[model samples]
Target: MLKWILRRTTGKCELERICSSYPAGAERTRAVEYSLSKSKLAALKILLVSDGLNASDAANNIITLKGVDITRNEGFRPALLQCLRHISGYQKLVSEVTRLQKEKYSTAIDDHEQQLLKLWSLLKPARSRKTSKTKRVGELGFQGNDPATDFRGMGLLGLQNLVFFAENYNRSARKVLSESFHPKFGYSFAVVGINLTSLILELLCKEQLKSHFYNSVSGEPSLYHFHRVYCHVFCEFHDFWFAEEPESVMEFSRILELYKVHLLSRLTTPGMRLHSEFLAD
Candidate 1:
């Protein structure tokens, strides 16, 4: 309530008078309130001056400050409302994505393992062989034969990200998989995909993807949008790794740091976007 009062009030005297309501800490509160009030008064003075008022006249009274605020709010009403709507939609999207991230993968669910196999098949055509599940996972470029163990931290969401990329952007996913097999610059494709999932989840938790989503989405973004971002990160990081020509996968951490810097620079731009073609770059 005090913060709101500080935001709306315009004059030092008026603010000092209002602060007296908190009788419990009258002197201390008044001092704090006085400083806040002056800062706001200074901002309103600047706002008025920008609107062509002389500083002398702008600083004279609270009435001018209220008039300036009313006019400014009225002029920017639609835009402010739009911004609020997108923020609300973003909260919903983040909540749903976070919920999905927490859903642990279960082998008891027969369809889960089948989905994993289907995703692998999409990436590389395979004959019907009676290979064990562990070997099949190994063939998909996981560090170990038991990919379920690899999914321990990120749960089903990690698998979902890998599957989404392969299923939706088959060509790009295959290209990245091929790049991951480069003799001089090889990486474990499944492991790297899982790592990228963790990276993106960190970004989501930190709210660093807000600029990208706010600029790109018209209404509400979704779990699919989150997966699309993972796909982008996977392909782009793959391209970046080869382009840098590192000595080996030993430099994976260094290369990943560079990739993160690259991503953050792009994501912070005024109108950042990530389309399928953009990911191809």
Candidate 2:
């Protein structure tokens, strides 16, 4: 019989001391875990050195990493499915914000909002190379508003109807991002958006299957115990799905692949905001 003398922890981590026991042949499993953890740390170091991931970027990514893993848990099929949808919805919000911020498009959200309004434009293309007095044109419809051809139509009925839902997620990520601005802003965003988003996420998570369960209880749709991680990721996922993401959102997916199966997973790390890291620095 053999016993490991110490519990595992990162060498630089503040944690210290433990009793660790494993099956006789569990060395291989232990090795894989150690290797994976080391790799994550190594990636962080490499990114820090080469990517110039300053204190703020490092802090943001860490907070963001917590949000991204929600959809990766395959075990919690229902929650995972809902998160996937939220992620897609949120990505749309990302594009909107990014488009509004570019040097070429720097303006209020509504300014470019008007430019993109052309869902379909009337055209005058003809087979005749020679042009004379011409009769008026052909196909015409709004650009993004046209449900027939426009990818993002308009309203809930439009191609981009889901953007409305995604907007909630963007608001969620903004709270996380607000750590860069002010603690009050971050807290404010979190409280306001989560209160609303929790409802939205709860609905999205339960609408199909859970809704049936609710029908029997209150004679209306209701979720009994709310999901915390589901809401966190729904916010993070949907924000990434619709908002102006850089590399942070993509990074979270990579981390979630590390965990094993379960009913649904809670966030491995408690979420953080810029306020905490900013204070740390």
Candidate 3:
């Protein structure tokens, strides 16, 4: 029930407050001193200190402060409660995000599988359908006959991301698909899409997505938010790829690694979000 407040200053992470203010009757405890260095991961942990009170005692202090001094910190209780509430809500939401990401890509053509087909049909209406998965993937500009093979290391999430871009940003998706045919500059559209999926998944696993999602979404970040990000990476990377004009597709692996490093640098900046127009034009 004790909500800890932490404020980051230039070089130190210090405990700002305990329960907003000390309970009136509560014995005065000296300020907790914990110095934080430049280690980014260390900055994320909330310093939880137990001040001789049992867990239940800590929980009770939040509810009934009648005998204690409520006036000590006038505005703190509500604000601290709100912060804790947001953290709780974020934890639940992020759990769901992680769960969706971890769930292996199912090959069985379920409802989502059907959605994938619908996206393809919408994007490539002129392409004739073949009964086999390989032909359908080929029609979408994959390097190989079977699209499922590309998802081997990744999973359903990769395919889902591609379908989402097509469904949500039909014009942009088709434009990118067309760009995949850029005479000398053209690359395998489906393969690159899957590669972008892997790139995004790596970022998510590293928890680099938090700031982007927090700034972008009004509520908790969702699977759709992740897909929107994939769209950005797909489109933006295409732009980057062509601008560099690699001689052959053989440069893809090297260029992709460098691109990831470049992209992550931008994302690591404080308060950075995927621009809305990243899906446009």
Per-candidate alpha-carbon RMSD to the true structure: 12.5, 20.8, 8.8
Please provide, for model 1 over 1-281, each residue's C-alpha lDDT reduced to its tens digit, 9 standing for 90 to 100.
67557556743334333433332222322233344346656754233113233323333343354333434334232332233334444566666667767877666667677778777688777545333265766656877666777777788888889889988888888888877888898988988888899899888767678767666665445677888899888877887898999998999999999999989888766456766675542
The deviation in Å at residue 116 for candidate 1 is 0.4
Models 1 onward score TM values of 0.69, 0.19, 0.69
The lDDT of each candidate is 0.66, 0.27, 0.61
User: Which candidate leads in lDDT?
Assistant: 1
Model 2, span 20-82: residue lDDT tens: 122111232223224324444564334312312243343334325423332343232232222
Tens digit per residue, CA lDDT, model 3, 52-85: 2232333234434322334654554443333333
Show model 3 residue runs off by greater than 4 Å.
1-108, 128-132
Give the clashing residue pairs of candidate 3, or none: 24-69, 105-156, 134-145
- Candidate 2, superposed: residue stretches over 4 Å from native: 1-173, 179-217, 222-232, 235-250, 256-281
Cand. 3 TM to true fold: 0.69
Q: How badly does each model clash, as a count of residue pairs?
A: 0, 20, 3
Where is model 2 poorest over a 10-residue stretch in terms of lDDT? 11-20
